[model samples]
Target: MGKIESLDFIELGNHPEKLVASSKQDLYTLCYPSEKMPVPSHYADFVRNDTVMLNNFRSFVAHRPFHWAWFLRLLKIRGLDESFLEVPGELSYSLQNPCIVAIPHFGLHMLVPHVLGHFIRQDSMVLATGNEEGEGVQDSIEKILPNDRTRFLKLPDRWILRKLMRGYQSSHYPVIYPDVTSSGDKRFRHLSFLETSIRVPLGVENLSRLCKCPVLPVAMTYHDDCYRLHLGPTLVYKEEGSIIFPLFSWIEELVHLYPDQWFGWNFLHEMIGEAKLLR
Candidate 1:
């Protein structure tokens, strides 16, 4: 008879803790003022060409009277104030707790912070990443975060971020640019490698799966007056073929359905490849 077999499990990655360590450097971890992001190559190129367009789009959003009014309402509403927001799914299932929300790019730029502030009251810490140049925006968030619940994480600095994540035990909702665009720019031709390669990193995905946390497919659009935060459906991976795949499929559908609001002046074009305009 063979000696009583001792069980040993082989992990996927070469260095499992290293996987943990690397994952620790999330976009949200560092305090704004102190964090520093080393600029990635081609980042400046992307910014140089798109600065004017982005600014114009941002102004368009800012100038909207409805946006202003909605923002004012957001300030007055509490985290649990679903009445003020146009929540789409069932209250029993939709972001009623701490969960990861995959918000589209354009709506995320301005409106997300308000959403974060609202949710933090219920102990949900909204996470975002920024470059060294946008430290001011990070600083502004830090100032507004509630002393009891709200917090901001700057992603550039790795060491500090690792410690922070370990201490806080937060979830990752990586903000990624959708691969569809309106512009014809070919700069992002190579982006297919970056785009579909993986939006949610393996480390982050594994963490969420292991923790049994739900992923809320989110997309917001400022249409007419109110800023609509659309919560599609909650995805929980119970087994091998869980709802994650269907959730991603629906996300792509939303992107196509609201291309204009989602893209906002070809930002998605630069980030991902250009969109094929409908004839």
Candidate 2:
């Protein structure tokens, strides 16, 4: 982790350039594990293009402090309002129904559930891992959101799926990050993403079937000095046996448009191993 001079919102907002520069070395190390090691095949294109890669790294670096400051601000505020987000008018109506909100690991992703709770005006459950980082995010959510508005469920529990099913049955929308890498999970599919294939979990698809609800793809990105939440059309199980491909496909498009806003770029190597060409 790089040192951030201050966590103040205004300070972070004003020193974006400094923030990016300060973390340049650390970001390089994260992207390139070893000087002798070649870039991962899936992320080779981004690395090959110096300008795009630098922008992506800059976004990766600056997003953290900005997100932390935003989180701190949220803790002090009463709650969020429609003015805080830029949602499409038509999509506003779609949020009325309880559906699986499949969000990718993008900019300010940790804030998606809280933002959705504002729009849906209902309680929702967010699925998170039980790791240190996951617990930290869970703690942040607990502190920022009213206890009644949202619930955080850690992953890998046997009854987790049942819990999600019941939550959906009770009209509690389940928020999931579909782009996470699943280890030793047989229920996954490989789909083309960027320059390589990525293994996407079938959990979201299964949950959608069990709950008989559609999967709504959501992305929260930082653009033009504002945090915008973009929503995609509902993906119903009736249309396909699996929505993993289409769901990730939409995320792929967003990543291309906002490569710097995507946090997944940092873990691209773990998601899909170094390309054979690079090896």
Among these predicted structures, which one has the highest TM-score?
2
TM-score of 1: 0.50
Per-residue lDDT, model 2, residue 235, is 92
Tell me which residue pairs clash in candidate 2.
Answer: none
What does the lDDT read for residue 105 in candidate 1? 57
Residues 151-239, model 2: lDDT tens digits: 67765566666777888887778877788733224577777888677766787888888888899998888754466788866898864
Q: Candidate 1: where is the Cα deviation over 4 Å?
A: 1-84, 89-93, 108-110, 116-124, 133-135, 141-149, 157-204, 238-247, 264-279
The alpha-carbon lDDT assigned to residue 192 of candidate 1 equals 24
- Determine which window of 10 residues in candidate 2 has minimal summed lDDT: 26-35
lDDT of 1: 0.40
lDDT of each: 0.40, 0.63
